[model samples]
Target: MKRAHFIYLLLLWCIPMMGIAQIVPENPSSGALQSVQNLQVSDVPNDAGDEINISWDFPDDLDKSQITEIRIYRSTSASGPFRQIDAFPLVLDSYTDADDDETGHIVTPKDTYYYKIGLFNGSEEVTSQVSEGVSPQISFFNWGRLNVFIILGIYFALILYFIRASRKGREIYIRTLPGLEALEESVGRATEMGKPVLYMPGIDEANNIQTLYSMVILRYVTQLVAEYETPLIVTVGKAFVVPLAEETVRQGYMDAGRPDLYNQDIVRYYSDEQFAAAAGVSGVILREKPATNIYLGSFYAESLILAETGFLTGSIQIAGTGNIHQLPFFVVACDYTLIGEEFYAASAYLSEDPKLLGPLKAADWMKILAVGFIGVGAVLETFGIDLFPRLLQI
Candidate 1:
């Protein structure tokens, strides 16, 4: 099976528990704090057993102005030798202690420990009773990100289902990309004019996502040009991309059953410098005047320079990139453009391979799910109901 890498989702952070305090064990500390009730210690949940959570209550009659700071103390035994772990202002009533404390104190998973709280004035201090035994327990899965994991599971299932269906000859419908549709027209025009086609796979490193997608599209284009026996030129910017582009071009020729037409020098190397590569490639656009010009991959400032130069040469141009900012320039200059994820979907669209098609279809389903979630969340928010938000807090 030809496996394609599934892209990741951007998840937001966990909800903060700033104003929440826990049940009391008893507070004996005082400066002007009469009864600092409910000093409790527990394990920090949904973590790798690396932290302990301590919380205390802010009493109704507490005089905040008279207190200088609140302090936390930790020890292995309840008998003696307790050391100060943290001190913070009167505003906060909770702290999360990590195993990597700067005091060289270490707490292992399932190790019993005791904690104490202290109140301090300008010159005097008072201490609280030690908390009961608390230990950090390692959790394999984070309950905070439970919703994200659930969504991911459903997405994977959809992918697997589609893959099996596709393999069994079930047809999947993916919307057509105009940029891709124009490739045939571009090649046909080049063949008619007896002029070569020029392809630039962006200026960034080959490992970049945009560059990687560009390579896939490049392979498809190479095969098209090979089938028509039209000359193809692949120009690259980064030094590392030279060999990859060469291999892809070679593979494309062989896949089209025209390996004899493959030329090693067809994939040319420019410079690693951004503008320098743009200038060198622009010179080729002017000199060769290729009938079709295709630019795909990660691009920066040089995007407009190359596209504009190709436009001036009156070539049938098609451009695609993941960079949104550069899309405006490509849209203005090129006859057709692949916008954002359209470039990513090219591999599945061109090949129709079951492995790639499954993921592409799964992503579409995920987007539909996302839109539904957003719509429901908005409706609930209008009614002052926070069911969806609270579900994420778990």
Candidate 2:
């Protein structure tokens, strides 16, 4: 028993010594076998100043095959329990250590940090001397974004020019949109048939640009319906759009000298749920069988459902949306469809207000300018003159 106990104690002591031999070099001079030299530390420029870049030179005489791993460590102090920041293949000589955690959450900012590179062979590691301290800083201007600023400035200038010219009473001419022209006919047919006209302001809140444009067209449509003495039904998918739609309809009636004929029930707010709103609107179409169905604004998969239901009701359907995918459905189901930007241009066409017309004219001119650029680019590309492409690069 004594002999067995003595052997067991000897084995435990030998195991720890073996581990120490593998992890730590017996001769300190062996660490010179692989070395990192001329270490550099600098803050990254044109950034929020939360990153430090570290670079060094690997010993040329060292055997590259023997180097299995390289690690980067950072510390706030020279005498440090250096935290391992990253590990990479032996080939890498540089690293960027952002003053953040692994998940990109900021841990330290404006804090001076020191870094060291480690070369590993199996369980053994040789560490280089510490680098000079670095602190991250923010720059006032990032020249990288200068090109974006220039483009935005040009666009805004163009819009302002048109707006000012319009205010000065310069008449801006816009060709009549087919969709706007058909509005009168739709209202007239509804009036003759003595059936109500149904208008859906899309399935979006008032904040949406598409919904705002829809309101602009709604005002005009309401006026036409009031003038024709036809009952109008406005169903909206958002509660926020309800009051806006109601007021627009009321104003239209007032403008047409038919305020007394207006009813609060004419404008209804449906559920915000997409399919639910679609179903509710579809039920309205089937039940009331409106002579005219006008759909304008943002739409999604439910677009086909609403348009198809209106088609089955034999209504003169006029649909418009910015969602391109749903355009095919509307084009097929509706008698007339305002495709993409045509829907936006319809409001300005019908209203002819200088406020709207000026912007419309400016947009058209901008589009012409864009086409010119494309043509120039194509010609240059054909001739192998790459200068134009480089000029466009930021």
Candidate 3:
């Protein structure tokens, strides 16, 4: 009887162990790796370009201890005979393609690449479904003759709509009192005082949207200065923007038919150091005593110092920055400021170019749709009804 009782106790302990093994299955079921969650890609920085980062989370049934290695594969086609490009020892749940120590792959604009990850445990392997093909999207306006017709068609339609709207006398709800208006007055004041008008394109490359927008506004402002035969000085902090700003200013003068009045020396490049650039611009303001100062672009901590110095110099300051934190300082010191999207809209507003205005109007209409949807959703929820609750499920 004693021997039998001991044997029963042993069986009871073993039963729990057996159940544990069954509950935590040693091998995952087929199609266990169905969900590929948290996939993200972003442009890589500080390179000649044409590089992107790809990363994803591991499968749900993934056994961290059993995973010996992870295999990475790449394919040009989505349904592909994927070729193994990289293999990493399972140290973490995620892997970054660009940072891998192995032979790095250089991406080309012409080729679209898809990625697949495989988790290996000795002989057994679980492969992830292939990622969607990723290729560089060519800008519609930049691409050759193939896209020219599409671009022209868009512009033509916008022009026709603007003309029709004008004829119909439609009341467009455009708000008055933009911040850049003060900059215009500042430029006019500088022209009268015989002092230069100073403009700074933010300290970033041409690829930066903020820098591009700054140049666009600069074009319009320079044209005004040219008409007044005023001296306009543009100091850029980035080497790439130097030539672009010069071209923009030169083109503006040419368009004004006063190329002779354009001063090449005024549009210059300064040191790329954030604080040093601020100091240099301060020196320019103090020495040159510019009657009007315009700061439009992506600015950091240096924005306040620049604006404050320009303010002290008795120059009419107009600042526009996409940086949310800097907006406060610009507001406190600058006479007029373009906040966020308003800065981008300046070119469209000044030129009254229909090509730009149509998109702006369309965007406003989309915003109205968004606000209406939000309001309707709130009302529905208050009444304990969900119009599209299934959308929140995934």
Candidate 4:
């Protein structure tokens, strides 16, 4: 029993000694194996002064077997009570020091900082000499986004020029859109047939750009309806769009000098659920048997359900949306359809307001310029010439 106790104590003591032997190198000269090469520290460019870059080259005579990872230590002063901030595998020789961790060592633009790179083995660490001071700086501009800046400047300039020209009564030639042309006729037919006209601005929320675009067209549609004194129904899927639709209809009637004819019940809110909204709009179509049905905005799977139901009601359907997948259904079911960009440009076309026309003209010219650039870039790249792409890099 005494011998067993002695053996246990001996094993415990020997294990600790072995660990210490591995951790503390028997020869102090082992550090020579991890000597850092051409250590460099500098401010990171194109930044808001919250980061600095530290870089070094591995020694040519590095022992890949002996090293596991490299650790980064930082301090505000050159001679530091330094604390480690980061660690990575030995294969990497660079670090970007940022205040990602809100620890004791903070990086800021005002203070010059020092760094040390330490090569860590499983049990021991060999640290490099202190790096030269570097401070993060606040750059006024980043040259990397120069392409985007130039493009935006050109677009704005085009917009401004067209606006001035339009105000001066310069005639901007606009192509006729079929779906927009049928809007007035649709309302007129509804008035003649003594049937209601249904308009659904789509299943999208009020904030969507497509919904906003549809609202512009809605103003035009309501104007036509108000002129004919026909019963008009505007059903919206989202609650947020209810008030917007109501106000738009009210304003349209006022614009047509028929505000007294406008009733609050003209615009109604259906369910928020996609299919549920489709069902409600479908129910409206079956019950009212409207002479005309107009759909504009973004939609997904429920587009076909709405369009098909209106088609069966024998309504002269007019459909427009930015969603490409829904275009196929609208084209087959609707008498007139506006695809993609046409739907966006319809508001400008129908209103002829300079504020809207100016941007439309600018966008057309921008697309022309873009196509030219793409063609030129493709040819240049085919011939191994990189000049065009280099100028437009973003």
Which stretches of model 3 miss by more than 4 angstroms? 1-173, 379-394
Per-residue CA lDDT of model 2 for 160-273, tens digit only, reads: 888788878998877767777899999999999999999998998899999998988888898899889999999999999999998988988898888998998999888999
lDDT of each: 0.86, 0.86, 0.76, 0.87
Number of the predicted model whose TM-score against the real structure is largest: 4
- Candidate 2 lands at a TM-score of 0.73
What pairs collide in candidate 4? none
RMSD of each: 18.6, 9.1, 9.5, 8.4
**Per-residue C-alpha lDDT of model 4 across residues 127-197, encoded as one tens digit per residue:** 89999998898888987788899899999999999998898888888888988888888888999999999
lDDT of 3 by residue, 76-185 (tens): 89889899877878545455455233556656667787887777776777777777777644343423343446535655665567646744665455566457556567
Using TM-score as the yardstick, the better of models 1 and 3 is 1
TM-score of each: 0.73, 0.73, 0.61, 0.77
Which whole-number lDDT from 0 to 100 does residue 354 have in model 3?
53
Any idea what lDDT model 2 has?
0.86
